[model samples]
Target: MAIIPRLSTPQTSPDTGPARNNRRGMMWLAADLCFNIWALSIAKSLGVDLPPIQIVLVRALVGLAVLIPFVVWRGGMVRLANPKLQILRTMLSTIAMTGNFFAVAKLPFALFTTVNFTRPLLMMALAALILGERIRAKQWIAGGIGLIGVVIAVDPGSLGATSASGIGALFASVIAGTSAVIILRRMRNEDALTQMIWQTAGLSLTSVLPAIYFWQAPGDHWPILLSIGVLSQTAQFCFMRAHYWAEAGVIAPLGYFSLILSVTVGYFVFDEVPSIGLYLGAVLIIGAALMASHKGKRG
Candidate 1:
């Protein structure tokens, strides 16, 4: 296990140190955004016919196959130590990944993305309660604003009007957010490669049963599945790099970019336009993300 550094305020250092790091961080952030768009595009192309678990299993297996070579090139099987913690992390990640994929498959892309934005707000509360990190008044305020945004986006009155699938997507966001906090905590003692390997492997193993039970042969779906696996792995790798160059607080907010990407893709590809409430909610969520990013910079 490696000790992950705590998030720190950006400080002046000699010779453009902070600036260079920020640039690198932003580059990785951009890469992550692109990767996410690709992943979503693949999901959209696949449509909802294939079982979510089956899709996840295929992606996980392919991701494992892709990553294994890299892991081996890095240092072979020895790169993975601390099997107990690895297993725990993998299980937590599996839940998050499974839930997220299911949501994507079953829900509208824009709505699904909006709900996913709740992760940062949840992270703030989790940090205070579980990590013993101080939560400032501003952050609490931001969290409230973000929650309001989520409500606006979901528009509870429309829950029944809309598909129950949307509600499931929202719930998946909660699970994913909590899982993220756990991953952050564990990251303090784990290498990024080790974390990725175990998480993907866990996803592969856990999804096996569902994939079998609901096994729909790949057919024309092979390409999309492979794309999802590759894109997801790349996005995660870029995210890890971003965090390494910067801090979680700094990089996390950039995740909001996914919403913009998703909305664009949804409109152009599926001819689905977001409602006013959705835009309003998106604004609030983006505001919260900005505030959080600023706080991270100043912390």
Candidate 2:
């Protein structure tokens, strides 16, 4: 999952020093990852019947609705900076989210989640390309390893309809999501809540018309629909708090748990028994991500 930009807060408060906060941060990050996966999994389950656009619309609307009161409570949208960049980032985020919903519906849960692990590699490359950051040899090697893992899991030789189109959507979503994160890193001075409001509002607006055109009255699934928004936004809150409380390296290992969660959920909840290739590929992907993150921290 993409890490939400850090909220504006002091690095260390008198009430909680670095050690205590680091522990708290890791816990929050773990919760955030769990909620995020659960939200996506719920969307995937719903996607079996509902239109992907409609699901995206509901998620975005619920997210926006939840943010409105918070925005009002903290005084109106007065903290925004770099409006153009914000719009650009929001547009990428919208594309990323819509594509993610589409992929979740089409791909196996395990495959989809594993493919997402490549986002860090993509982000690292984007940093080098867009931000003109130097790419060390080890990082490049990690990216190569991640790509190989993806190929192993995808098994391009057996490209059926399942792997072909969903793979495209999955990668597109990951790239767009990585781009949004790159932009977020650029907007470090911008208020985190303001960025979130813009994102939710943008997603809602972009998806509304399509949703209306393809409108299906969520019927009995309204509760599930509502939960997507609630869970996702809560997860985003945890993500922001996690960053505020600790360095990325301190919380990085917890991210590997997502794969275990994905595999378990895929098997039990979705009855997806991935082949041995998937397990092998996942190991390589996770190892590469860990190496990249570690090198990133050191750099």
Top-scoring candidate (TM-score)? 2
Tens-digit per-residue lDDT, 1-299, candidate 1: 11123245456678766533767787888898888778877876776667777877877887778777766676864455567666666666656666666666666678888887777678778778767889888988888898899889878777663357646755865766486565557566766656666667777888798689988888877887888877877787777667667766656666778888888888888787889999999899878857764644543
Q: What is the C-alpha lDDT of each candidate?
A: 0.72, 0.82
Models 1 onward score TM values of 0.82, 0.90
Q: Model 1 compared with the native: what TM-score?
A: 0.82
Query: Which pairs clash in model 1?
Result: 2-189, 4-188
lDDT of 2 by residue, 1-299 (tens): 21244455555667765443788889889998999999988988986577777877887887777777777777886647787888888778877887888898888888888899898899999999999999889989999999999989888887788668878888889999999999989999986667778777877887788789988878899899889888887888788788777778778778878888888888999999988998889889989988887744443
Q: Where does candidate 2 stray beyond 4 Å?
A: 1-20, 296-299
Cα error, residue 127 of model 1, in Å, equals: 1.9
In model 1, the runs with Cα more than 4 Å from the true position are 1-21, 79-82, 244-253, 296-299
Candidate 1 overall Cα lDDT vs. reference? 0.72
